[model samples]
Target chain A: MNGLKQHYAKIIVWAILLTIPYWFTYIGGYLGLANEIVIYALAAMALNFLLGFTGVLSFGHAAFFGLGAYGTALTIKFLVPSTLVGLAVGVLTATVAGMVIGALIIKRRGVYFAMATIAFGQLFFFIANRWNSVTGGDDGVGNWHRMPINLGFTTIPLFHNSLVYYYFTLLLFALAVGAMGLLLDGPFGRSLMAIRENERRARFLGINIELHVWISFVISTAICGLAGGMLALLDNFVNPRDLRFDLSGVLVVMAVMGGMRSFWGPLLGAAIFQWLREVLSSHTPNWQTYIGIVFVLVVLFFRRGILGFKLSTVKS
Target chain B: MAQLLLFDISNGLITGAFYALMALGLSMILNLSGVINFAHGGFLTLGAYFAYVLQQKIGFFGALLIAPMITALLGLLVERVLIRPLYGRDPLYSLLLTFGLAFILVDGVRIIWGPGSPPYQVPEWLTSPLSSTYFFLTGYRVFMVVLVVTAVAALFYVLNYTKLGLRIRAGTKDLETLSTLGVNTRILRNLNFGLGIYLAGLAGALAAGFLGLSPALGTALLMPSFVAIIIGGLGSLLGTLLGGLLIGVAVGLTTVFYPAASEAVIYVMLGLVLVLRPRGLLGEEGRLH
Candidate 1:
């Protein structure tokens, strides 16, 4: 019965997501906003791969995410006009960045690790901000959009049609999510969980803690880069803000709000956060305060998140 | 050429002094409470803004002294209400709470201050360069360095000579044992948080005179302090101080030859420091781990 319920949950989630493009407008969200939610959800889930699954706190994921954006943007803007190549370059860039940064901070633990990550994340932001000639600097890299996909005989116009782009993104999201789900169910993911539970015990059990963490960090960043690439494609622009620590913090908040431990929690969290941001920003200028208040409230009271809450009766 | 180098070094030291002031507060809270206090920048901004507002009524010196105290009180209150409960939980919760609070504070400042750089005036004499040959030695810069020295000295005196200081040092080393010794750790943590915030506020007030009163003022200064703490090594106040000074000089020197890489130079220094000394320059082994 439990297995059946889990199966039902997966089906329901996929069903809802598959139909979002159709019903999103009726729910006061545009297709672009839906794409954004999915992309952000992908990034948040990627962050959760480290924060929740591995029990490692990385406030620097934005560096990878931004790298993905800049990589995709710069690639398409200057290097190539192909959307697929742009995305591959974006992910590859984030992967290389993650590998280097992960190796650097592999030995640091707890808050030190988090601090190092934040500082490193800001390094990229500064680089992007200061490297104005190549990066377009603070103004952001613009005047380029995602090109159409040419599958030999057929061409899909990703630039002109938002719906086509949305489906394309959804397909990529499924592949990434599927890969993550498989990894989480496998041995490597189990080792990450062990490290999260107790590093000393995991170390005692002969698990290579640092190696596992570095790998987890790299995987999370690479996935986050994919999300960043999608974001750049969605907007056809990438800015230094993408690499800023604030976005990193926001990604962490999304994971926590949706219940980091739960596999799909960040998706729900991202959806809620994106929808609220859309609605709130339109209604009031002090939307960030409201979002911040939500953050405080979540950390204070709803830390278990929507999925984390349990309805159990206590017998006294 | 020598004069130019000297000018940059002095300028770097000035900025480094500011970083030390802020970093010392951050290191204090991290040592004692195990909280990163991301809202520290927020508090610093608040202090600067408070000074800006108070300067109108009571003048510069009066505002400078009172503004940080108000910010400290607010910090104390926040610790009691928001941070107190999160103690003994995963440090992640406190970090997140503070991170969120930073967001609120930044937005709140924007709402109140109208998102523009407010004109923060020092005395007329302070604005003028004290030496004709050394044009960079503005009276304001010298006065800022003096205040920073005085603040650091006062801080050291309090830590070394006072009972509260004794308890804070003890707590940073071993909060659990400090609590076992019946230190009323609740109050200790609260006061420690307040004291750290007080430094931030003070730094903010002084920083406003140089950087001008903008919402971004705290953020611009925030990353350098983190680098300072990292370079100095965690759990060492003196190390933090040295780290700040080192980075300031590094940045100052870089600006002379490579203006574009000036900001990036400190980070490069941080990388080199991390590689050369992982635990930080003065960080003790197994202190925070």
Candidate 2:
């Protein structure tokens, strides 16, 4: 019974996600929005890997995200037409940048780290915004779309069919989430939790704090980059705004809203955020105020997060 | 060629002065409160907007004098209501709260002022160049520099000479000791937050004279200020002032030789600073935590 109870949340979450495409539109959402929620959820969850588990506060995850986005978008647009190639290029771009940046700033902890990340993220934004001839600049990369996957056995018609693309994204999300779960259950994840709880004590225990943080930062950036690539694919477009600081803030809010401590919390938070954005943006031009209010309310009242709150109640 | 170099360098210095004003306020709040105050830019935008509204009522001089005080009052209320509870908690919560506050302030400005850049007028006399020989040096530019220099001098005076300043410095170094010594650390923090916002508000009012009043004005300056703080070193005010000016001049120099890389140059300096001297030029070591 105890074992089953632990897995219950996972089962229910997967069940809903697996069937979301079918039922989402009945509730006035479309397949594209479902795709967005999942993509953003992947990015938020990636951020939570560092934020929730590792105890690092990065206010600039958007740099790697945009890197991944531009890498994939540019690869497909300028280098290769293959979807898989674009993704691989995108992930590689973000991973390498992450390694260098993480190495440079891993020693700085807390708000200083956050400040550095924000500044660094803007560096990329400036590049993307100014490199107009190549990046399409403020206009962004249009006139390009995600190509279909050319599997040896059969080509997946991702470009033509929205339903097929949704499943493809879901499959990738599941793989990333699964890998993250396995990592968390290992000794490496334990080390991160220790660092989050008490850095001094963890250092005293001789856990090699900087290496762990640097690795965690790199992994988080790689995942965020993948999400950015997917976002470009989703819109068949990419812009400097995709990697802007505002998106970084939104990702952090999603993590906090869903319960950063819980693995699935960001996905839920992503759904809520996406739904709110869709609904509120249509109703009024001042929707940013409402989103801002949500951030304040969550910070004030729901810091435990929706999932975290439920878990606490269950424990009690 | 020499003339062009001088022109760009001076241009950079002027921009640097603006960045220094903004970064000094941001650095003070970060050092004392451990809150990043992402809404510093929002406060700046609010300050500019406030001056715009007040300018019609009492003219530019009165508007300039009064707007920052109003912005600082708002800052105090924000510290009391939204930020106070998160003091002992992880700095993350306060950071996020301010991040959200920034969004609200920007959007609110948009809703109230409309989404366009409103025409902002400085006194016509101030807009004119001080001399045709030095055509780039407008009276307003010179006036802004003088105001910033005075503000910095005043800030240093308060920090060095006043009771509140002493407490703020002591608190930044060791908050627990200050509080235990019956200093009322809470009031100290609130006042410090106001003082920081007051600078941001003042910068906005001064900037509006040349940059014009736009919702995005604050956001544009926000990044450079962060770079200034980082380059100046994390906990040192004098360093932030120096960092701001250095970057401003760097950008100005870049514009002369390579205009495309002008904005990118400051970031390169930031990266170099982080790699070579992570504590910043004057930042104390072991302040990383």
Candidate 3:
């Protein structure tokens, strides 16, 4: 009986997530709040796709996330009013950038790779921050919002109904998450794991380690782009802050704090982190220090993360 | 045009000295302990604040001498308490811990000193302009350059001649062997970390005069230092020193040609270095992998 219940844990977790918006009323939380958590959770999961599974650490992934957001926002404001089209363009642009950068920096591993990503990532941020003409510079482009999703027969009124937008965002998040799951269960995923486990052994066994790392980088950022598109819609604005190293650091911390080794670990991490930030910020102005304290604790004790601990301590 | 170019070059040389000074310390830490000290900028900020406090009482010369040493003591304490245990672990923990430490230090300085820039006074002799034709070449800038040169010379002398430097170099090359040969690796690393922080503190004190005393002092200088190390190549101190000067000059030239891209150009140089020679200009081959 216990084994049967354990097998259905994933379904149970997904159901809980799907119904959170409805039950959020009981906890005095609004739809917008739940939506934000889902968006961050998805973003954290995307980061884990690279950090946890691929065994690569990227310190500046916000470049792609912010790119997707700006692409979506700019496309909607200047090019098209269709949110669907905006999202597609945003993801497409982010993927291309990721492919190019991943190809360039994938030659290095570990800390050097992280440093390279930070440098490359900061380049985009500085451009966005300085190019006031196109990017609107530091204040970020405002007076723009996500358009209603046009489904040919019936338009999804995402702007008016918060619940509708939540479901729509959740649908895309599910698809992105599903894609990652499938990829991780395949031979390519096995190759990535092999490299992470032992690069020397993997190289000797005929795997092109750099190519695999590049692919992982591209794939991870592509999903991050989708989340970024959702994020632009969530906040109705995209700024250089979205592209900053701070957000990249947050995503990595979320992945590690939640359990980098487990698939759902980052989602849990994102929820905990977002909640902690919200609660702490509301209560005290020194929330950043507290967050730093949290980071210190996680590094020192919970390196394996919450799920990692649970898996070891709990019997099925 | 020639005059403007000369002025920028002179200025660039001074800025390059700052980069080389800071990057040398960073390279020392990176070489000896494969950990990227993300809070290095925090140390720089702390050094600046300490000088700000000390200079008010003792004036520039005394504060300049003592502030960095105090910061080094703090660095020693921090390395022992926070950074020591994570030494042999995955480099990720050290990186994250320091990243977190950066937040604490930056915020702590802000809380203690307030967020705005505090008034910084350099000695009048140092601040006076050298010539009406070259008003940009102030005595302070010259002093900064000479001091940097002297410090670099001192560092090289220690590394080449001293028993500590010999042991550090040997340990960096082959730690397992160094440990087997009866050297106290722990003390070596702790002192090395202190020495590295001492340089950061010195750079911070010098920067406070030009940039003004602020909480944000260290972060602004940190990235370019990283670029210098990357451009110079890892493992070779000469590479880092050369890398800092090269980027400093590049930034100076870029300011003249495309002022908007003065900062971005360093990152671009980093990208070029990585793509062209992943090992870096003076970096030992295979250290990157």
The per-model DockQ list reads 0.50, 0.56, 0.45
Kindly report which residue stretches of model 2 are placed more than 4 angstroms away from their true locations once superposed.
Answer: A1-3, A309-316
DockQ of 1: 0.50
Per-model chain B TM-scores are 0.97, 0.97, 0.97
Q: Which residue runs does candidate 3 get wrong by more than 4 Å?
A: A1-7, A309-316
For all candidates in order, the CA lDDT equals 0.90, 0.90, 0.85
List, residue by residue over B155-203, the lDDT tens digit for candidate 2: 9999999998999999989999999999999999999999999999999
**Positional deviation of residue A232's Cα in model 1 after best superposition, in angstroms:** 0.2
Q: Write the per-residue lDDT of candidate 2 for residues A1-316, one digit (tens) a residue.
A: 1457549988998898899999988989999999999999999999999998998989999888899899999999999998889999999999999999898889998889999988888988988998878998899888889999887899899999989988988998999888888888899999998998788899999999999999999999999999989888888899999999999999999998998888888999999999999999999988999998888998899887887744331110
Model 1: per-residue lDDT, tens digit, A13-116?
A: 89988998899889778899999999999999999999888988898889999999999999999999899999999999999999988988889888888888
TM-score of chain B of 3: 0.97
TM-score of each: 0.97, 0.97, 0.96
lDDT of 1 by residue, B1-289 (tens): 9889999999899989988999999999998888888888999999999999999999999999999999999999999999998887777778889988988998899999989997997989889987889988898898899999999999999999999999999998888898899899999999999999999999999999987888878878888888899899988999999999998999989989988888899888888887888888999878545
Decreasing lDDT order of the candidates: 2, 1, 3
Candidates in descending DockQ order: 2, 1, 3
By DockQ thresholds, what CAPRI class is model 2? medium
CAPRI tier of model 1: medium
